[model samples]
Target: ADDDECNNVTNICGEWANCSNTNGSYYCTCEPGFASTGQPRFQTNDGTRCADIDECAVVRQLCGPFSDCHNTNGAFYCTCQRDYSPSAGPRRFQPGSGTHCRGNHRDMANLTESRSMLAEIAAKTSGGELTSMEVISYVEALSLSSSWHFEGRGDMEATPSVINTTLTNLVEAVNNLVEKEELVAWTRMAEDLRENTVTKLLHSVEQGALALGRASSTPLQLDIRASEMELKLMTFDLAQDQLSVSMGGDHIQITPKASNGSVCVVFVRYDSLGDILKPSSDPGSADYSRFGGTGEITVNSQVPIDVDADVTNCAFWEYDLGTLQGHWATHGCERVLVNSSATTCSCDHLTHFAILMSSGRSNLVAHSNILTRITHEIQSTRTTIHKNLCCSLFMAEFIFLLFCSVIAGLLHYFFLAAFAWMCIEGIHLYLIVVGVIYNKGFLHRNFYIFGYGSPAVVVAISATLGSKYYGTDKVCWLSTENNFIWSFIGPACLIILVNLLAFGVIIYKVFRHTAVKKPEISHYENIRSCARGAMALLFVLGATWTFAVLHILHETTLTAYLFTIANTFQGMFIFIFLCVLSRKVQEEYYRLFKNVPCCFECLR
Candidate 1:
């Protein structure tokens, strides 16, 4: 009764199929994957030939949608179609297996590309070989330097981990921007940041071999903030970013290359997984411009074209590469220049610059250190002007003019003080001969008032009547613009003449007494004493400014040079005569050095 019946079921089915044995009769049965063709359902009778069933054909709604189903000997597989890829579930599975597909591979590709590009840019910032893409991104092609020529690409490079991290963050930021549709502002972000890409394959033992594009999964903010070492302050608030700076009076110029140059971009690859873009929450009001405005800028022969003011205006803007006006307006605040390429901001007031493009070679930005210094000066000026009642009286409008007035007033007082002191000296001598002293009395008080008050009245009257005479046309102080400086010169000459005459008469009397013993003055007279006394009298009587008189009257070169030379060194001469040349001062210096040597000897 045992009929050679496929015993124990060894080798009864093919390698791709399953097997089972019947009763004592020993019949064959196809397993789950293999079946009999043209039979009822998926079952097969004994002795019927077993064949592979096409699950893809029998089931119409298999593997969900946008996927391909393929039949194998004993199993079937599912795969995503073009523009779609499997994101969830097993790739090789049953026909009705639940798997998902993603559609934003381009966004991921864009991210990967931009990240690589950024890394390349950061590397070049320290000075090295740069690609055309970097030149475009830096907008450095518009710079004044001729060295920014194009270097061909084709090297799929890896950058420092920190730079890679920066690129990764930037990619995520742009991806977020894309989701919010704010990217529509910039040439549809110039084709959603498209660029060149190269793939990298990796041999993974556990997961078999793999391939991918260079990119980061780490998300980032659209507002780009490079590391402090990389560049100046930069930010993009979806629509605009603000940079506050003050360049001291160094001439500013925004020099753009203006010439056309080649361009390049970055890319990454993931062979099996491909690339993907994931959407997040919409950008909140805090991350973007509040008032509706134009993100586009226009430039032709002039600076930035005037945009509608009703549109939201921020403090700064994103600028294209070019020469810009940076117009510091006295009227409106519409002068927030985003990309500044100006080389000539003024030395006065809060200048609002206009962001404009430039061509050819020139410095494109101002230094913040210089700007900060200027701001400090401006603040100091404000503080000083605040203390003056005259400034406040005029509502602080004529500060420069006031500064000129102050200098003029000082010059007027110099001569007045000298004349007053000299007159006092003469009166003191007369009183000494009469055997009288007025050190403390109504007379002394009156002398004090005349010495100080007279000069004040003179300067005040001059300033009121001939205010224009105070300063030069080009500068703030007295100049050759008019004979206005004569207000200072005229009094100086008169005082010199008066002092000379009075001192000369006094010196003549002393010399005559020294030449011959005078009545009851034999003990007070000597030729040596007379000469020394006369010199001292001339010095104390303010005769040093005598040469200056010759200078003011005659406009000859010798006189001019002499006048300048004297005045220029007048302070030094005073120091020499009073402190350096004095016998007491000489003794003091010797005493200092002698002590130093004595101390050293003691230490030894």
Candidate 2:
């Protein structure tokens, strides 16, 4: 009972195994850096098969910090990183040998000697001396490099490997008077050596012998070429909108005529930055001999530069992104705004990008907050280019532009659907107001055919004539200037005019037949208020629509503004007549909202 467990098995078990005693038996287990190879075992040290383990595979990165680990079949080894040296002895070590790397590469001899002496003193002090293992762990923690790189600071951080963060824990650990003075002396020596190394590197960089960014003394000049060679951004005096770009130019811009519309900018590089950054065979030289760029880019680009809006689609459009969902999966790169944060997407990754323009009166609101949302969409679809990804840049741009045209054609069909309903409402209003009696089945079927079929015929005929009809200037619609605007304007005006005439005829009929009661005034009172309130209802329905017609015909600044106002109020008048003034609607509104106040109070 008094004999120790380890003492009893010390002879049978090899140094690599630890033995544990159970009630009537004892088992030997291999230690941390050792394992059994499934061999038949005997109770003697020679028969027990405890073998060295490859710590690199077991721990993933089992070497000392700031070092590289290499694995062998049954053993592992570590080598210090660049500008670092081993703390124990030289710059390499075997596994289970403990921490072997520390900072201060330029003065390795002096710093290593000082660290060793301090560790020895800590191991053999006044109290119970610390073990060699404990001293190594303590010294390793104090000697490890702790300086962090600040990325946003860019080239300013300078990344000098000679300097290392101090071991503040050592200042507190040493209580002996002699050891404390030695700690201060070693700290000063390390600082002076680091400063001297940094000064030398700096001097070499200034003399053009060392390249800090792999950049040359002269700024790199890039020859810029563009697809639309003659295009230029319009000056403010020309129209207040434009786009263009030039390399080495004082000002950069990119745009075409509003009617022509849209352009793409591409970035190109001959070789990757990583390749140029590699060290040359000559120690003092770098491989970045031919790479050139002053590294300046100006956005100065605009969408729908001189383009105008039309009736069919919005001057601003939201993409139907579902159509493109799986088409881009094979590119190994996702669509993102060109920027450096996309580390996984190298500079050369290609993507299809489109700048779809809105047709809904963009000019008036384009420069204001109303179009700020459209600007954001353009930004989200903007392409990101990396230095390595210069290939296929123009091809992707062309593909994206073609995709927009196809999407616009599909969208034009949906726009025609709205006309389908507008025509139906007009025909129904005309028949009822004119007092034309017909079978419900006959009238409904004919109007439905005319409503849905007429718009489709117009769209197909216009597109067959030319798909460009929908790609007027900025939006996907009938061109305002190409007489194709008539596709929407003709049907819209016909519906509005027929309804207007119907309202007029109804008013005329009401005045001719109705008689006023002579309660307030004589016969003149009846003559004075012709049709009484009938005229008011007729004007409410038809007058708002007349404003649009007048604006198109006159095409004045005042009429342009008047049409914008009329368009906004048109929906309001429809809502008032169809819902607000209707008896059934009034009842439902009150019923739905009657308990709203009570419900709100309960929630509160």
Candidate 3:
């Protein structure tokens, strides 16, 4: 007789499969809600395997709208999405179970729904069934609902009650979990998950406290106690003078600056959270690990102080919502006093406050002294450097003043000389373009005498008339007072008018030459060159000074800007017109840079 292989100890069915016995053989089939990898029926040795079928993926809206379908092994379940709940039946249901999710819009408007939700969360948390993801999801849902209600109603008066209920219940649940040691696993979880959970809890509490403060105009104090934790909230009108508050055993004194809003302070003391938030042994871990292992005191004064500890820090939870992370920071807080039983803190702002203490007094004090010495040395060096810099600046100003008078006289002579040379240029261009008397040697001699000799005479007369007007306290230029400025502007305007007249004549001659047919190439080129040079000088030398004159006369924003730009780019215009646009100058530049490896390649 054939043996019943399905019933034998060495059954041939794979995991999640059922074995069936036939007349002379046995085959394997996947169990209900699972599918076989190969054929529906096959022997175990044929590489056939059974896998749980994903009903949710295969069927659309398997859990209906507004719900999330959670696939399980050989089964599936459904739960409502955030801000929704089942209209009927249990929270977790199956597809087509006559249960539909309904929006909690109306429910979230009042405190009743929030109370029920908080109660549920509290029960789950206390029962050790709430996960980190669930906690975060629930808090996010509550926050979203609160924000939505406020946006819809344009008020948050009703939100404080909901927030208050959430806080009270959450504290109770966390306290119960602490008593049962269920939260011990928090420290063992992944670092990111642990931090996210803590951040959410702290943020939720802070939001509740802020809402309460805003809703009430008068001073308010709420002290909530749990078996293993305590929460203290205080709201008071901000004052210019220092104000102090004491809670548990900690004390905080803050002098708030003038503000239009009230100040809300929250202090949470979690005996178990401290144990779970143990400092990492590795120094290179997260910033929270750097906190000492002594103990934590919450809000003004509540936790038992560790007097023997060497270091005490008054810190606040700095949460960055963008990154969804938080860490204790002592930026605006100072440790005022620390004794055997109590610690005092002073802060410049309001927030969730705590006291962090560490033992090992000898090592800490020694290290602190070394740090203090290093800091003092750094500060002293900085002070010396600053003093030296100030002295150098003072000496520089003094030296500048001492030579300013001499420089001003030179500038006056040079500026007049510049206009005198511009006048020579206009005359030269006029002679070239108009085919008038062009005496190279005679004109060159006269150019030098007029440019240099005339400006020297002007400077001499001006200095003799008013030597004190050569320099002013603000600048080394000729002073505007006592009509001294005209000494320079008058000559500048004369040169500018001469250049303009020369430019107009050159343009007329060029246009007349262009009208001639079959004109001499040499004459044509000369006229062209003269026109270009004349136009260039007209703007570079004459137009800029014209704008300067306008700026002095009208002093409008447009004239000031135009004058500034024209002067600033004067050198650039000269280079472009006299060198970059000139064929002879281009050849010279190429020859100069041809020997350079980079320039040679670029030129080639």
**Winner by TM-score:** 3
Write one digit per residue (lDDT tens) for candidate 3, span 106-141: 322344344455566567566664443454455554
Q: What does candidate 1's lDDT look like per residue over 240-268, in tens digits?
A: 23212211211122222333321111111
> Could you give the candidate ranking by TM-score, starting with the highest?
3, 2, 1
Cα deviation in Å at residue 594, candidate 2? 8.6
How far off is residue 138 in model 1, in Å? 42
My TM-score estimates for the predictions, one after another, are 0.28, 0.32, 0.35
Ten contiguous residues with the weakest lDDT in model 1: 198-207
Q: Clash number for every model?
A: 37, 20, 9
Off by over 4 Å in 3: 1-113, 129-167, 173-180, 239-242, 256-261, 281-316, 351-353, 358-604
After superposition of all CA atoms, the RMSD between model 1 and the true structure is 32.7
Better-scoring candidate (TM-score), 2 or 3: 3
lDDT values, one for every candidate: 0.38, 0.39, 0.61
Write candidate 2's Cα lDDT for 1-604 as tens digits.
Answer: 5455556644456667667666665567776667775533323444666788767767865775667987765566799875456778656686477666665422223433333433443444324343323333333332321111121324433332211111111222232211322333223333334223222211211111112222222222223222211111111211226433332211243333444322223222111111111112211111011111122222221222212322111111111222311110222222222211111111122221112222224432321111111111111100111100111222223333455444554445443444344434444555655678878766656755664566678778878887665654455445654566667667667766766675667666545544533455545655566544443344333445567687666545677677766644544444455435555556655666677996544433
Cα lDDT over the full model 2? 0.39
